[model samples]
Target: MNSNYSAQEKNFATALLHNLWKYLLLAASIVATVKIIFFGFDIDE
Candidate 1:
């Protein structure tokens, strides 16, 4: 029973991490888009 619970917990943690990374990437892209819209796309400067 304890082992089963541990396995479930581990799976939950893995899923949480996966979702966290997904959201982080989404947030980063949104921030980048906002920056480009406000600042213009001046990569050289």
Candidate 2:
């Protein structure tokens, strides 16, 4: 029950996983910047 992925399928799956990681990193950075701008706009202390 664990032998159904061919070489092409494996490559595609690996590429998809890598692409997901890249997008997640980009999203995280964007969210962090937005949060800081909204909550820490006044840094006098």
Candidate RMSDs in Å, in order, are 3.5, 3.3
Clashing pairs in 2: none
**How good is model 1 by TM-score?**
0.81
In candidate 2, stretches whose alpha carbon ends up further than 4 angstroms from where it belongs are: 1-5, 42-45
- Per model, state how many residue pairs clash: 0, 0
lDDT at residue 33 of model 2 (Cα atoms): 97
- Residues 10-30, model 1: lDDT tens digits: 999999999999999999999
Q: Which consecutive 10 residues in model 2 have the weakest lDDT in total?
A: 1-10
**Poorest stretch of ten by lDDT in candidate 1:** 36-45
The runs of at least 3 residues in candidate 1 whose Cα sits more than 4 Å from the true structure, single-residue gaps closed, are 41-45
Tens-digit lDDT string for candidate 2 (1-45): 345567778989999999999999999999999988877766633
C-alpha lDDT score of every prediction, in listed order:
0.92, 0.87
Candidate 1, position 13, lDDT: 100
